[model samples]
Target: MAKRFQIFLIVCLSISTVTFMLLWQGQKNNKDDIRALAQASAADACIQFTEYQTNGCESSYWYGVAAFRSFQQAYHSLTEGTNKAANYTFCNEVYGCLVLSPEISQSNISEIIETMSILSSDVEDENGYIRMSELRNSLTR
Candidate 1:
């Protein structure tokens, strides 16, 4: 009976240790995945916005809306846990543009293109990843 109990305890501890290690690694990988998703989403937004510019809003209204929605989602995810005035301002501005008529929206194509250009650069830069890592570290601490 004593020998069986010892074996059981050893197996339980080994299993628990392995489980803990896997969970830790999975969490790290998840963070990396989300970061990549944010980057990719931003890039897609830029591409779609450029397409909207090329095709014009009269014909590509839906494309512009879709791109704007994607940009909003990606921006929100990337900026989570950080409070910055510029973030809110940019989001609100884009939201306003999204709600306008197609003719009005066409007039704002330049603004949308510029915004996407800036966002693309930001997401492509290491600073975006660093910011997310710092935020994660601060929370863990």
Candidate 2:
């Protein structure tokens, strides 16, 4: 009886240790994933700004697009529940840039992201082609 009890305690301890390690690792991975996602979105925004600059869109448009792209990941990261103060600052910066210009509206990015969020999941997830079409339609108007 004593030997069995000892063995049971050891097994429980090992399981607990493993569970804690897994949770810790999972959290670390989540942070890394959020950071990567933010960077990718920022890059995409930057590319759009570059396109606007080369295509003769007004400077305001360029600024707006560039600013939007720069902070997208941060905004999404926060919205997705990171809740870091740096994320709040990033959101402010992005919001400020959009608000500074009358040539473009914040709704453009909001609409774009709204569409993206919906289409990201298969049930409501609009594919890339569908998103592009929706974006183009938004742009035309």
Candidate 3:
């Protein structure tokens, strides 16, 4: 009976420790993924801005869409786990943020990206969905 009790305690402690570590790592990864998203979008903004400068609004819009598609394609490559739906939702939120800003110019992309970085760092739920109910701007999409 004594040995059985000890075994049960050890098992419980081990599970608790592992669960804590996993949650901690998940939180850390959330931040890291958001940072990466900001960086990639910033790079895309530069090219898209160049397109806007050289060609026109239509050209820049298409270029921006393409670059954003690339970002979406690579986004999944950055993360892995049971939280894929959450990640997708988070990504869509950030994508909406990136596109529909009031000031969507070359000079403003950095500010937008920075805002995203700041917001994403703290927007995740315990389940990893970035359900930012209090966005600074109302998201129509």
Candidate 4:
């Protein structure tokens, strides 16, 4: 009877340990996913700014198409039970850039630059696409 009790306890302890590890790992992965979404969205802004500088408005427009998709991903990420307004701000600004991407031109680049600056300001998650400064710098150049 003593031996049986010890075996059952050990088995229960092992299962509990495994479950705990899986839960911890899931939490870590969620954080990584959040970071990745922000980074990709930031990249969308950078690409739009760069393309506008190099290719002109038309180039920006095409890239904006892609950026829109990227922003959507970022937006979806932000809304994933996180419901952060700052995060939505970041996504919306990028989405704005994408919306005008098709008509991108010297005339509008300046305005887009302004929007990017506002978006790059601060975020609920520090790991987000903190690259707005770089994007803004490119536009200013």
Candidate 5:
């Protein structure tokens, strides 16, 4: 009985230690993980937007809208606790785009496609955050 109890306690301690280490590691990389996810979402949105532009299908347009929303949500999550001016500005720019006009002109579609392409390119570069700031600047202008 004593031997069994000793083995059981050792097993429990090992499992708890592993769990704690995993939790600690996850916490350490939480921000990086969120950034990666947001980048991926942005890329997806860009692809969807491009498809809409190429196909000119109503469904494709809706898909692009949905993907853009996902990208926005992920970005918002990444900046939730921060009070950065750039973050707010970027969010506002994204929100303004989200409010679609009933009739999208060709120029507006071209601009959206161009913006999404820039955003997706950020995912490929190491300086994605800086690129995103640049995107905000372009949008504001």
Candidate 6:
């Protein structure tokens, strides 16, 4: 009976240790991913700015769309385990910066890109889809 008790205790301890280690590693990985994402966001901003300057409005719009798509895909992938709020916030920050840039004034190109960025970053499930839809309708005007 004494030997059986010892074995049970040891097994419990081992399982507990392994569980803690896994949890710690998971947290560390999440932190690293967030850091990498922030760096990527900044880098994308700089590149998009340059591309817009050299490639013109149409090219710049495409770049914005591509970047948004990339973020959307990433958010969906991580939704199972990651914080959806943080993901949306990150997307919104990058989107707003790109869209609100002075280089994309209404006199030349559509300013709806800025609004779309704002909508995409919404945490309360209020992505500016309605506004974006309206803007699209006005594009032919």
How much RMSD separates candidate 4 from the native structure?
A: 7.0
Clashing pairs in 6: 119-128
Clashing pairs in 2: 38-73, 45-69, 119-125, 119-126
**Candidate 3: misplaced stretches above 4 Å?**
1-42, 49-56, 82-85, 93-137
Model 1, residue 102: C-alpha shift (Å) = 4.1
List clash counts for every candidate, in order: 0, 4, 0, 3, 0, 1
**How accurate locally, in lDDT, is each candidate?**
0.58, 0.51, 0.52, 0.55, 0.63, 0.50
Question: Comparing candidate 4 with candidate 5, which one achieves the higher lDDT?
Answer: 5
Q: Global CA lDDT of candidate 6, please?
A: 0.50
State the local distance difference test value for candidate 1: 0.58
Predicted candidate 2 versus true structure: per-residue lDDT over 1-141, tens digit per residue: 999999999999999999999999888556555545554554455445444545646663556455455445444553464344444453444445455643444346555454334323321122533553555455545
How does candidate 1 fare on TM-score?
A: 0.57
Off by over 4 Å in 4: 1-29, 85-97, 104-107, 117-141
Which is better, 3 or 5, measured by lDDT?
5
**Tens-digit lDDT track of model 5 for 6-94:** 99999999999999999998896587776677677777767776777788776766676677667677666777666654654665565
Reference-based TM-score of each model: 0.57, 0.40, 0.37, 0.49, 0.59, 0.39
Task: Pick out the ten consecutive residues of candidate 3 with the lowest summed lDDT.
Answer: 127-136
User: Candidate 6, which segments miss by more than 4 Å at Cα?
Assistant: 2-22, 25-30, 68-141
* Candidate 4 weakest lDDT stretch, 10 residues: 132-141
lDDT of 3 by residue, 1-141 (tens): 999999999999999999999999888666566546744653574567456555657667556645654554455554445456556555566556546653443334443334334433433323223332222233433
Error of 2 at 33 (Å): 2.6
**Cα deviation of 104 in candidate 5 (Å)?**
4.1
Candidate with maximal lDDT: 5
* Candidate achieving the largest TM-score: 5
Candidate 2's C-alpha lDDT?
A: 0.51
